[model samples]
Target: MSILRHWPSVRARVGRELGLVLALAVVAGGVLGFLALADLVVGGETVAFDTQVLMAFRQAGDAAVPLGAPWLPTVMRDITALGGTAVLSLIVLFTVVYLVLVRRPAAAAFVAGAVLSGAGLSQVLKAFFDRARPDLVPNAPIELSASFPSGHSMLAAVTYLTLGVLLARIETDRRVRVFFPFVAVVLTVLVGVSRVYIGVHWPTDVLGGWLIGAAWAMACWGVVLWLQRGRPALAADG
Candidate 1:
């Protein structure tokens, strides 16, 4: 009887501890991301690191010959397309429609808002930095936009992670809940890597994209959690 009585208290304590840990993690991530962006903007050591990594992928004297198989460039181009505007937009549209059909209009709206806002923020930051593209690589993609942060990397992180969290929320199985976000992160990382492989972005660009995108996704998740907290009974009923 005493053990049973104490079990509830123990569980509650554990839950509170977990919540605290998660909150701390989110704050730490956001702070680190902002620091990185500030360093990049101020032309700190990060710039040198970015240049070194960007150059390492190319041949010593010839930026055109990326250090990979002859066909790797083609493969990277294909992989990069997965994070392009067209593909991500289609993904967001389909997800919103699916959520609406399933009668979760709020969740659908959250998804749309998170992705669209993230895309807009990316453009604004790019223009604000107005950094030039890497001219070291002759075969790099011809991008006219500023290149401080890669659009593909940031948008991919935002869209995929937002969808991942949404999918995880609907899963009843614990394993499935974990799996959804894991796959989402994997896809995001792959997309970012493809940008560097193709020489369209500096390493720091992708890093900045991932950091800001993740921070944005986490913020949206907090909103979802807050909104849902008030409707626990309704959530349980569904």
Candidate 2:
């Protein structure tokens, strides 16, 4: 066809890549949807595995807390802070301020949108599941909305991943720059695990959190990639 003849190769390749990314997002979302549905199906509005795991994790945390070294609690607290609202809030504020004060509005907006989108999705998932907290922890100091997919785990993946993406976009070194996402992935996982270690969430909750969060991060980064390709304003050299 005439249209095919005129189409640019680069554009065509990009279109194919975008289609693949979109397919991946759909599959990921479907998996989460299925998991949620299965949860409702298995126990009729109850999460069995998630509850059991959370209880087990909480018990483990309780037993370890007293027997563990003095510094462990402090370390867990620091890691747990990764999922705390304060940390995520500060990250957004700092990034926005840095971008605005330096007059890089486009980059700021793109990154902000990317991060907020992930946060919004996390809340939606939390509300959908509405799982309970661990009773074994005995003293759950801070409050939580849902138990299955931790808010902290989700945020850690979202915010930290967004930070990694932004950093990678600006970096010159290929290998070291790649570490941004790798480290963010590691930190996100550690924070999620710490939630269970500290007895606030279950192991299954963290796993679900990791799956959903990691998938969301991937989805968001996929969007960033598409945006970079689609719009000149949001495009970065990397």
Best by TM-score: 1
Per-residue lDDT over 1-238 for candidate 1, one digit per residue giving the tens place of the 0 to 100 score: 9989899667645644554457447747965976667575657657687778988888898878888889988888888887899999999999889878877777788889999999999999898888877777885779898887889988998999888867766686989989999998998898998888778888888888888888788777766554444244112232
Which 10 successive residues of model 1 have the least lDDT summed?
229-238
Write one digit per residue (lDDT tens) for candidate 2, span 68-168: 57787678889899788898888888997888777778777766786687678778877877877766665555565877577788778778877786786
Evaluate all candidate structures by whole-model CA lDDT and list the values in order. 0.79, 0.69
Q: Count the backbone clashes (under 3 Å) in each candidate.
A: 0, 1
How well does each candidate superpose onto the true structure, as a TM-score? 0.86, 0.75
Those runs of model 1 whose alpha carbons end farther than 4 Å from true positions after fitting are 1-24, 233-238
RMSD of each: 3.3, 5.2
Superposed model 2: Cα runs more than 4 Å off: 1-67, 230-238
State the lDDT at 165 in candidate 2: 63
Residue 51's lDDT within candidate 1 is 77
Report residue 116 deviation for candidate 1 (angstroms): 0.6
